[model samples]
Target: MENANRGYERLFGDDGLTVGATFPLTSARTTRPNVGRELALTERLEALGFDGLWARDVPTDWPKFDDTGQTFDPWTWLSRVAARTDDVALGTASVVLTLRHPLHVAKQAASLDHLSEGRLVLGVASGDRPPEYEAFGVAEDERGAAFRESVEVLRAAWRDAHPEVETRWGTLDGTLDVVPKPTAGDLPLLVTGNSRQSREWIAAHGDGWLFYHLPEDALRSYLDDWNERTAAPFVTTCTVDLAGDPEADPEHVNQGFRAGAAWFRDYFRELDAWGVDHVIVGVRGDDRERAYERVAERVLDRL
Candidate 1:
């Protein structure tokens, strides 16, 4: 696949590793964060040496799930981030394709890609939230198929003029076309999670893979499995709570780690050596700016 998008280039490459950050960049245990403050922090992303910024698509607040995923619409929030920064790739950790119309996603993603000058890399997924399925009138069991359809639609809508497509979301005849095609002609679609699809299916379809954090041994195994299927890039999410002590040993936290800079440096190196292309860092600290600086100085620069 042709990766002409700047964001795709910034995030994925050969024999290299880069780091990005996710929203709710601070340790605010709330559904929402201060938008102005967050925007200000975004302006400094590239200056801080971060390569990308990620947003999550949380259609609604599911208290049981307990994560608001930045508590803003992913498209709107990313536009704001795009306006404030230059160069850093803007991404969705994974948009819930099952809940959205693929044509709409295609238009919005293409528009953002242009507005940001080809700095959009969409990570798409079949949603996992059960209640959201009911709310959106989407069948939970059929999300896998819907996800595949959405991916197909998005690619067609972007690459072809007035492309013909037939799916559960209705048909797009060769009459009207979605305008403002991605600057790269096609955007990079990184499949998130299994998305209720077979590993072979994901490998064949996705331009890349967005996976969650795993233990070193497990990650190496997963990478090996992925390499056997395809040579596409692999990205993972890592949530870290940086300690005050530089040499502090890592203590596993929820889905991530509470560790110091020293531990993270070693961990990132291992990931790089394992052929992991990028990591979307979710900082779990009160002072996100300080934590970002620490990682930049102690981990990223050294790498």
Candidate 2:
């Protein structure tokens, strides 16, 4: 963990599971906002003892995707979040690296990390939305290579004063530099999913892995595979819509479960047992406020 960020260490500590929040902190999936409410919720989440505050990168309003992802440019959004919060780890649940230039990403990520006082956790991925790829004029088929190249550039820019990297994206010939290095000197790069790269490649390049939700057995199997590949941390997103009953059993809901606090606590314990280092819990429901309170009371407090 050389050059590790303190906030990151708080969020994903050495040997235990931690929980974090994803914005806009409500169940809404569209592009409109109660910006003030969201910010207030962020402060409240940190006070409630959440380890991290995560933002997503969705460059456009792709109708098919449905999820608008907090509907803000991540750099601006995260810098703003950084100012308003004191202790929570600031993260991109992931920024799509394929659509963006590496130099721009490096500069912006470093800036945010500095602004947040080393709280930034850079979650990155290749472009996933087909329409987004078309709009960026990048070939979807070439994204795998593009993603790999971008990772190299981001790392080089942060780790070296004048990074000279030669890739199809372009060369950083050491003539110029991406300034404002992260407080840790180099920020952690948590690769989101395979990103069209092999598991081995992720193991070699990424500091950690952020995966989508899968069943317990499936996630365990995947973690088993990752254990063979590398010793990096394993992270996953869980969209929770907590039930009213403490003893309610789990029912399926959009890559997560609709379970009561009793079941939810037990389920998280199960995930922890399965080597899931952290979970990005996206609570979804009409009564998100109630869910939030209940989460801290019955679920998080007990955990």
Candidate 3:
């Protein structure tokens, strides 16, 4: 918990409200690797006073789902973003820990955290895609245990003097330290969704929570459940397609809200009232410039 505190302090500071925007990995209809454009967008968001930038982890191909994420590796993109930007915290909405070896994740996360000068927040999950699990040679039913053990391994690897971690996934010799040490000496690990883990486990382990889109009433219920179980704050990411028109009708996307600036203000206000610490907005749809400007002018001011 001390390490968790260090990680939390580096990212959240004292505001208790860190507004951020999700990095757009894929264009509307293109598969072109656009880290440059995404970096430009991130710079714009940073100048516009957003607190952090969140990346998504989509490692495998799953066409039927039509993933909005575009399936780019999160850590690679974040490393690029970290080098490009100075102030904004670099983060992943949720890295699929179950599919990856913990040592690799720990090393990469620690390196990014060090490179970014303590601005990395790692959100991890068990993952839901059966195909992804199959591709990774991981059984669907075993992901829960895999996820738990992975977290344990990562933590053990990053400890003050590193400890031996032996699990079904792998084994670590005594005290195998993962470098570079985090700027705050520990990487913040936020859990996404339930990740097939119990509330008590989450409450005791996770530094924070990453939840997806939910209605206000439902969000309130979910947050209440989480808060009651764990006193730590929760962070949620949702997509938004801001319109030029102030009276734009609300459109729905997967785990996102598409509306005008006015609507966004109201939505964020509701989230603030609910004690949500951070909201990462994924801006999609047309007129990216107008959306960014509108959010900067109307939405960022309120946050």
lDDT of 1 by residue, 109-132 (tens): 999999998999999999888999
lDDT of 2 by residue, 260-280 (tens): 899888888888888888899
lDDT of 3 at 55: 81
- Among these predictions, the greatest lDDT belongs to 1
Write down the TM-score of every candidate. 0.97, 0.97, 0.91
CA deviation > 4 Å runs, candidate 3? 1-11, 25-29, 68-71, 243-253
Q: Among all windows of ten consecutive residues in candidate 2, which has the lowest summed lDDT?
A: 26-35
Model 3 residue 211 distance off true place after TM-score fit, in angstroms: 0.3
Q: Which 10 residues in a row give candidate 3 its minimum summed lDDT?
A: 1-10
Residue pairs with backbone overlap in model 2: none
| 15: Cα error in model 3, Å | 3.7
Give the per-residue lDDT of model 3 (tens digit) for 87-206.
Answer: 777778788999899889988888878777777888899987878887889999989999999999888877756568789867777746667666666677889999999878988888
Q: How close is candidate 3 to the true structure, as a TM-score?
A: 0.91
Error of 2 at 288 (Å): 1.9
If the candidates were sorted by their TM-score against the true structure, best first, what order would they fall in? 2, 1, 3
Off by over 4 Å in 1: none
Each candidate's number of clashing pairs is 0, 0, 0
All models, RMSD in angstroms: 1.3, 1.2, 2.3
